[model samples]
Target: MRVDVHAHYFPADYLDLLTAHGSRHTDIARIPCAGDAEGDIDARLRMMDTAGVDLQILSAAPQMPYLEDAGNAVEAARFVNDRYAELVAAHPGRFAALAAAPLPHTDEAVKETVRALDDLGFAGAAVSTTVLGRTLGDPSFEAYWAALDDRSAPVFVHAAGRDLDSPQIADHGLTWIVGAPFEDAVGVLHLLRAGVPTRYPRIKFVVPHLGGGLSFLLQRIDDNYLHYHEAFPALPSTLLRRMWFDTVGAHAPALREAIDSFGADRIVLGSDYPYFQGDLYTRAVRYVSEADLPAEQVRAVLEDNVRAVFDRL
Candidate 1:
């Protein structure tokens, strides 16, 4: 069973709410959302069939509005979670959703997360990499982290946007291309330095985009820790291994490096589906197949690891 863990779908009601209320990110208005399988059932199923994907662990587009009024954000989150529940109920085996939450609004976000898991039957919760300049490692989220850890829930950390105010890469479309992955890297680094994995050992985190260059940066991070131990304490290699990564990097070399760094059991298949970067669903599978990995390792990447991560589904 090939499970694509990183697919995206934006509910129409959520879109309408964002559009009507004036989106914080202007680019959202220009994007084609409803046309994609945000709420459509047949279209997504057909694409999954074509891609040889048995199931898609769906999530809202990472560009969820975190800056909206708390009340509006909570309402939007409920609408999306309800829609996800409806979809999962309709197609029990074909799809499972990662519930959206109104993050940065600590109390509301925590409440929505519990509701999404307890009542909505979602696989887990999906959150942006940063919440209003606060990374996931920020101390303010202790309660939220404790809740997830207590439930042993899997949290999918997606890149929403990057520091656009920075003068460099300000004009180009680098925000989506470069900034997105950079945010993922920064988030992972913050989580590592803040000792989140060690602190919340039971909380399973699924970091996107080949762990935001984590596989490659592990040496640098650890080497730097030796010099800056006081500033950022060192983390054990085992703790780092506890985090899961998705197979979004289509290139053979990159995927090979990820497998070497993270091991196959820690990596799951991901096609940033319906997004331009997700166009390589079949090709990603093929890349892993042709990488000369053991047959079992490939199976782990495509299916087993996902089931293990989102076991509640």
Candidate 2:
């Protein structure tokens, strides 16, 4: 019911820990949506009200724990996941959650996935495109993938901030502008190449930023696949149908392309709330409602699709 599926919220303790740990590699205060009391339920509710969102599936922002030390990452993950569980418990219908896990720490990530799903009752797990420079398609993550597949859990793949050190994209804030979307596209394409959708068909994956320009890039991927049929068992289009995308950063044209490519049932509402990209929340929700699509399609993207994807919650 009017679910904003791509909202982010960090717990107080987790923020403190992140502030204390230099290994996270960035200052929390520097985060765009940071410094706001994200864990404050009243503030969250007020923002949701203003945005006309009935519910929000809270997730960790890109500040997700992806450090080198497994122990530190695991501890941070527990703190984050526990805080998410607490929020979900404190406000039942207003908020749901996707558990945070220590990516790059394969075994611990798997364990946290189990606890988050089986014990914490989170709708899914939130993960980044790359884990400490390693793409999601890395062999090290097979067990982790298998675990999520076993439960058919939804995995929301969000883009971490771009790699600013790259020579080509270091200028004009391209890291946030171009690199973020680029990383998402690359990571997703890697998964497609690895046949992850075919191998672990049960895991329900959700990609943000309207599949991160994937609608526009699918043709290129298909062209490559056509040239090397032996390398690909199936086209990205085939596997993409098995996944879902959220309507963040997708305006009329992009959203239309996504619907044409991935269909309405595979799309859901996502506001990227409280991080307002020029009144992102209200404008995004309004955009869908006012789009040229039929009312049924709007309903599917705004409400029904989310219910279907995260049905357990």
Residue pairs with colliding backbones in model 2 are none
Question: How close is every model to the real structure, measured as TM-score?
Answer: 0.91, 0.92
Task: Give the per-residue lDDT of model 1 (tens digit) for 1-313.
Answer: 7888888776656777776666666344234432334534576676677778888888875656565589888877888788778877878788888878787787888899899888777788888878777887888787788778888999898886765345465577677677777778777777777877777778889988888778888777777777667345445345568889988867778877888887878998887776632245567666777877888988888778887888886
Instruction: Give one clash count per candidate, in the order shown.
Output: 0, 0
Residue range 11-70, candidate 2, lDDT tens digits: 555777866765443453244443346545676676677778898888885878776788
Residue 255 lDDT in candidate 2: 92
The positional error of residue 239 in candidate 1, measured at the CA in angstroms, is 3.0
Q: List candidate 1 stretches off by more than 4 Å.
A: 26-40, 230-233, 276-279
Note the Cα lDDT for every prediction shown.
Answer: 0.75, 0.80
